[model samples]
Target: MSKHEILIVDDEPANLQKLKRTFLTDYTVHEAKTGDEALLILKERPVVAIVTDQRMPGMSGVNLLRQAREVRPDSIRIILTGFTEVEYLMDAINQGQVHRYITKPWEPVALKEALRQEIERWQLRKENERLSEELRLANEQLEKENFRLRQEIESLEPAGKQLVYESQEMRELMRLIDRVVPTNSTVLIQGETGTGKELLARYVHDQSPRADQPFIPVNCGAIPSELIESAFFGHKKGSFTGAIENRKGHFELAHQGTLYLDEIGEAPLDLQVKLLRVLQDAEIMPVGAQVAKKVDVRIIASTNRVLSREVEAGRFRQDLFFRLNVFAVFVPPLRTRRDDIVALSRYFLDRCRRRLNKPIPSFDPQTLALLRGFDWPGNVRELENEVERMVILSEPDQPIPASMVSERVRLASSTGGSDAGGLKEKVAEFERSLILEALRRHGHNRSHAADALGISRQTIIAKLKQYQLDDETAEG
Candidate 1:
């Protein structure tokens, strides 16, 4: 453990010096001649306590401490005042802005005792928070392990769902799929693009009894708006001008199997109504047909979009979303499951080598480091393409050089992904940092943060919830 840092701010030249000297023997003291300088220090580093004079040139002590609360929400704050007015100072204490206020001509021993007590309290509070977080994380990890073991995957090999992974996240996802694969319930798979949502959908179908049956995939967004209905349900020979003969629709083709609806959120409003009918009745009414034909197809929908928001926006039906979300699966982005990155890279390298008949032994260690260091915003697909490119550029019977990697990847590797995140959670930590920075830069306004991030107001609300952040932890 290291000594706690404390910040002292005062307009008087000798005052801040005296304050710094007093705490020099106890803590790491940071002296700021003005409130602005103190806030800059707070932003740059961590300080457990703030000691400031109540009077300043541009910003008063109460106001500065109030903003300091936003900068370092957990830091203890105390104010020194010599004036007769106590109304605003008391208000600051009441509002939790100032933890305590001391009068001028205070005894050094009394001030030191007060600061010690408050600092001890702050330390206790922080330790409690740290322990609570550790307990929460431990519980979550135990639950994950229990769930995976409960599925009995360790004793059995699932050849049907052969996803290449060595990550805990993937194992947990496989556990979820194992739980839902035995049933005929509809599944909705959601994730960022290139995160293998489609692959997960296939895993669900393969693990189920429907493995032997047809697996029909329909791109909801690729079909024309005028012919979407016709495409979904077979058209009669004379139904439309271009209808030459009858054809089996996806639902019919996938009878007794799985009908994958990729990008399901792109389905039009009218088509969504029809889809809901089919999901409810397991029947499809072909174009120019008076009777509905029964089909026994299991629906599996995949989307990169948020369907719940689409329902609220009236672009999607609530009933359809409810039906499709019976068994939900979220494919995490590749950057998250970095344990699989090296394995995937090697797998792709071998495949590419075999295809091209290249004698390249392997990727150089420096090259591998660059591959692992990138954020990979485009996810697995981007990585696969990059591996293929490197294979082409490598010399025969030699390890691939670091220079063979793309310039973009090289830049990302060199900067270590721009302090984006720590080792375990790059995406989340980076997102948290950006959100906090945006909040601070915009006067701790949530709306301003949302705008700065180019996301909707509701979206920012959801992000705040996802990160377990308090929306009201802002400066007034």
Candidate 2:
């Protein structure tokens, strides 16, 4: 800790010496014979506390304390006075802002205690301000990191990556994702189904050093329990009754690349042990083969299940859990990233139009509002599907009606509820309205609508799909 400086201003040389001696051991004491001299010293140095005599030639102790407050508002002030006048004390308290008043013939211990307490208060205030500054800086850094991560995710130009969201928590998580992406660390991504866990995993792989290599995705839950090992480790020709020829496992194919093991919590306990061995040794033993083959594969595992609970229940190996948890990233569900919903919706709509080779349709105000209000349990994937459905159903020149959207989604525009729920619903409603207004301004032309929204034509189509406002069946 830096030394605390105390300024003492008194006309009498003896009194200045006495007070200086009392605090010299615990603090750095600067003594002055007059208030003007003390002010000069204060201007030159950083003083944490000030002690002044009430009676002086040019300036009183109260006036000096008030001046000290202007220079250092946080500085502790003490007044030393012989007068017992109530008016003087009141003026000292009001103008000089004295923290404590010391009468003539003061007790040494009492004076020391008062000085110590004043010093403590000053230190505490400084410390709190410092901590607050640090927290603000930390939050800013986290937001930048999240922004970079989101950009990286958008660079993928995935099917549904056009949503706009303003969640601090999600931004922090995105920053964590960026930090862990460059290394070959095993990442465990957790979230509910459709929460874009796979998108996050893919982002990690794409941004990693092994971006040039293949990204092999495996759904652990999709594979049969009996064929788990053979599927992961490969099988030699005639190794088993169905093994017609030698086939390489996902591990071999993913050499020097990323293997996204989705739904890893569903893997059987026996397979978990094998998976652990592969992760630890960087080698795999193929089915019906005695030798273990070394491979350079980066593991990016994801699961919606709570693995800690699984470990506690003996369903997942604790050792394996630790190995895969070198970096843990949680993808927030759609409800958490509402800021990105409109952007994502527009992106999906555009993609659907491109794929269907049809002109993109416009979204009605009510329809856009309903899309935002819906609770997307299925996440980005669900949103994409909904958008595609709408695009195929609506006509090229027609605007999608709000009546087509489910009532549950429409309720998002309603007033009052839980803070999280209400905010999400309101944002959704706002997004819907914005999109419709843009479409109306552009005369239902997707290209013009995109321009009006200050986004690309492709982005508008994606948005249309995300809101489920396709133009397939509308009157052209």
Candidate 3:
């Protein structure tokens, strides 16, 4: 059988025979005495190109190609007509019924060349479509693998724990995370406080090839500046007044694993230079030591502060920012993902109920609406606290009511921020005082205070920074 198929149509017997004989050496040629006959042959067999005569009985070449388009839209079409009848085929060309045409008494070589080119075009298009399908399937498989990795991480969490996401933006973010996970490249996660930046970092580490190794997480802002060097690098015995013996620092502890640097923007400038050196050389020089030890650790850093802004303000080193920002993911704040608020609220409530041994099981519609309407400046962390409080206070087996929601969320929803600035300032003032009281009640221990307030420790730390609460001097 010939490799390519071609159909030729004409009203005369001699013309049809000549055309068939011309292309028979290279193609499987089908012949028709009229346009109607050609279309009938096309319905029975697939052809790569169709060449038809313009003047025919019952149907014309243009009409046949137009109908043939519905049957084989991918076929290449050419019209055969006299030089004087070229005007008639112009309309066919304009309507997309024809690709090219040869006048009567055409050169056999020229016609053969044209048909060969059409066949090549068809083959190239089919190839492109095949490649596109392969790419689509590859992406689908990657998504599945990412999801399997995420579930593996989830298995490590307490029962009923899952990342609550309903927004398209968050779903896309998950896809991005899946693509970036297998690579050892450094990743920088930027988001507002309480937006789960660290969770994303953990996801990356868990999905990576280094999943079996330890995943060390360090809060750069929480570590005291005086001991930052010792905390990051090992300390030899008698290095300082408190150094009773040699100690392994974060780098040594995290060797062959992943090291997560949280609040990286808060690292002191002098420490940033040292951190940059370690990142560059994959080695650490411990305190009071002349020797630098090599390390094999992947770095994944996160910061709520915009490091670019910090760099501009001369607070963060530009070199360190570039090293950590090889790949970046931004976690959307809860306010922008309001659709997930109700789901997250339910999830947190379930966890709180199990922990506190409470019987409250759900939230009434009014309470759900109240939760969704709030701006949630503290994002998921604050929402969890509110739901926990509601679960603790509501009666057993009862749905949480709007009354259980804090006044800040309730009043903001009711007023619609008619006086946005004044209302926001007043709200900030109330939040600062509330946080202060919680801290005081917990003996100034941020962790205990964070647990009591139902917010993340990072959120509490961020608030303290906003209110200028000195950790060393704050009484409560």
**CA-lDDT, candidates in order:** 0.81, 0.78, 0.83
What would the TM-score be for candidate 3 when compared with the true structure?
0.55
Task: Tell me which residue pairs clash in candidate 1.
Answer: 359-397
> Against the true structure, what is each candidate's TM-score?
0.54, 0.55, 0.55
Question: Model 2 Cα displacement at 170 (Å)?
Answer: 3.9
Worst 10 residues of 2 by lDDT: 157-166
lDDT per residue (tens digit) for residues 202-294 in model 2: 778877998767678899878887898899999888888999977778897777778999999998888899899998899999898989999
Name the candidate that leads on lDDT. Answer: 3
Error of 1 at 476 (Å): 68
Candidate 3 lDDT, 198-217, residue by residue in tens: 87887888779988666788
lDDT of 1 by residue, 133-227 (tens): 99867964664355345334522432122357878998898898889898998889998887778777877876899876766778998998888
Model 2 deviation from the true structure expressed as Cα RMSD, one decimal place: 26.0
CA RMSD of all predictions: 33.6, 26.0, 24.4
Cα error of candidate 2 at position 450, Å: 9.5
